[model samples]
Target: MEKRRLGRTDIDVTSVCLGTMTWGEQNTEDEAHTQLDYAMDRGINFIDAAEMYPVPGRAETQGRTETYIGNWIEARKNRDQYILATKVVGRSEMTWTRDSENLTRQTPAQIDEAVEKSLKRLKTDYIDLYQLHWPDRPINGFGFHSYEDYATDDMVAFEDILGALNRHVEKGNIRHIGLSNESSWATMKFLQVAETNGWPRMVSNQCVYSLVARRFDYERAEIAMREKVGLLAYSPLAMGMLTGKYDSGPTPKGSRKDLFPTFLGRYDLAKAAIGDCNETAKKLDLTPTQFALKFVESRQFVTSNIIGATTMDQLAENIDAHEIDWTEEMEKEAHRIHQSYRSPVA
Candidate 1:
């Protein structure tokens, strides 16, 4: 229940942020609302969602996640009590998000349309932190580990994207901006553009960081410390791999891995590393979930750890992970695991 400053902004958000990407796909509306109520009661003050959410990204259930949050806001009338963050889709072929195009890009006009729709769906006048879900350039995000450079002239300029977000800040539609699934070079480039053009600076970079995945620690950690754009780490549990549920037996029924096996295929290469982590947790007299969550929370560059769940028990366990006292032995064990695996899931 500790709060941290979001970048250089005046807002102080909880270190644990409730993630709602499973609202409409794996959970119902009522379940989503119950999760929200319980999270608020537990002192979580930040909620993160996206326009192209409830993942699997089908045309049928695209925006239902925001609609669920909107209904909760309408019913509770407690919009002022928490910080809200959502995202706009970057360059992709999932064109169902927009009305006019078959591809989604971070162009100025597309940003305008995306922000308006998100506001209407969230039932809010302004978003505390609006994020670009990914970069406009052609790069492998979402679990790929290859690097390929594309034609520079083929992509939208970073200045145009920041300029568009600045217009939203000026109009009171968004209070701040952030990035997701971005690289260190691009993060610095965005900051440079903002400083040179006198535009809004990015407040955070939301990415995947867990015990089994340490890609953010390589170079972005320094940027986070120096530039003040700290990390909002998602999937800190490695998409349920760190919970020890899969270590002993078959996949549990209705779990994320069971429902969408292909989505978490990135962890396949790190199966041995994950099993080692679970064993390390037991040696430390802690559950794998607690160990994994605390390691992400203990990082100096982490602004908030985004936790998601489809059931009440899972939600409670994830939130309670904040209470664990990080010990020296735990840190050393984590380092041993890292030295052995060395970002197997990255």
Candidate 2:
């Protein structure tokens, strides 16, 4: 596994990161710990989670993912072995995450509350990397091709958000700060504000980046290379579209598509392109999983490719994809797919 520097920080995370969004929802506590153990044995040292995880978030299963991870940390008693990363819900209706607040905004009090709660759940004094799950702004970040108008004035100030996170850093609640599902302009703005205040910089941008989803390549990729806020590519498999599991026919039983099809509605926007990508993978003599995962790992701006799984076999295959050599022919095929599709999902 290749190690890359996380932003300008001293941390060097593996090119492959273990994602835990499906841990509590699709899998059990033992399964989450099993995946964590296998990932560490495979030389992967980065773990990504969120406050609103087990995807399809609800009040019942909220924060269960972190609780499971905290259990693993307690059992292993080796918190220093790997770097743990988690996020706070940003500007949403996940009010259950807070003590008494109705809305989950990135305000100072909310951030403070979120940090303390995450620390308590994660069973750690300090988080290695803390991220805002999404921007506090009122924009449709969930893949609206053309920007729909939103009230820009009705949002928390960037300075306030950064200041809140900086306070957590100062208090030893988190080591670094990051962003997710953010726009190019917002990323630059946060970086600039952090520089001005001499606060902790945004180390990485966790966004959708796969063979079928390449919106990050348009502008944020440059920000990643130049500013060091590199891309922590999530959904790098297009939610299993790139793996060819949904290529032929009906959704596999008990799979993500079978369990929660609406969660994959974003990929439905680029169905034809996704099909072509899977076809391209076969033409290159690579499994679609290897093709998709390696493509994201090959990007210059990608700090780490976040891979998730519900079973050991899928987890092993995802990690094995990192070992394959990304060839020029593969890159050319990926480019051809991009030219035809042109990021329809975004």
Candidate 3:
């Protein structure tokens, strides 16, 4: 794999980041270790994880993904070999992430709490890139729309959030900071705040950017290109929907759809566009998975492509997708599909 600069930071991450959300839930520790080993062998130096992961995030299994990575680091004793990135959960109804306070905002205390616990769980002294998983503001996310009255609570201020991250940077617990599921306006605001306050600048924006989900290209791609906050695109395969296995109907057994039926609600809502994209890929003589993955990876705004899988077969195929050279015809087909769907989920 190739290396790319993470925003304006000195760090260089692999173009293909190994995603670990399914590690503790759908896979075992050995399997997680195996995946890490394979990814490393393939020269993938970027590994993304989260504090509340192994999604379908339960109170019991919330931190298991980090724990599995921690175990891998301990067993391998090669923490410095890769660039590690992890995230702090934004405000959500899942209050089990915190204790007794009912606090979900990015307060200084909460940021400290999240970082320390994540470091402990990850069994590492420092994270290469620590990310705010999403905005604390009230917004329709994860494909839900229909705007409600925008009420601004006394949540953590952007400056305070950066301040907290700077402290972690000083302590060497986190080397850099990043954002996810954020908007272009928010990205510019964060940049402005950082520039004015002389605080740590955000290194990247991790968001959903697949062949079917092209909303980022509308606005945020410019932020990435100009501000150096390149994209760490998640769900590049639309939760395996673009893999062409689900087009034949009733969800495959043991697949992501079967395992977490609600996981790909956004893709399901835009199934027509996804079908068109798959068809276009077939017409172009490319498997839908290869076409979708390569298209996302080929984006100039993309710093890295985060890929997840429950099985090694899926993992291997996804990793192999990086080898396929994206063609202009693939881009044209992707654009045609988007013209029809035009962000049905968003």
- Specify the highest-TM-score model's number: 1
TM-score quality measure for candidate 2: 0.98
For residue 109, model 2's alpha carbon misses the true position, in angstroms, by 0.6
lDDT of each: 0.95, 0.91, 0.87
Over the stretch 88-202, how does candidate 3's per-residue lDDT look in tens digits?
9888876777775574777788889999999999999999999999888877667845556566654567888888999999999999999999888778988999899888899
lDDT of 1 by residue, 86-131 (tens): 9999999989999989789999999999999999999999999999
Per-model TM-score, in order, reads 0.99, 0.98, 0.97
Worst 10 residues of 3 by lDDT: 146-155
Candidate 3 lDDT score at position 25:
88
Candidate 2 lDDT, tens digit per residue, 41-98?
Answer: 9999999999888898998998999999998998999999888999998888888887
Show the colliding residue pairs in model 2: none
- Please report the TM-score between candidate 1 and the true structure: 0.99
lDDT of 1 at 51: 96
Which residue runs does candidate 2 get wrong by more than 4 Å?
none
- Indicate the TM-score of model 3: 0.97
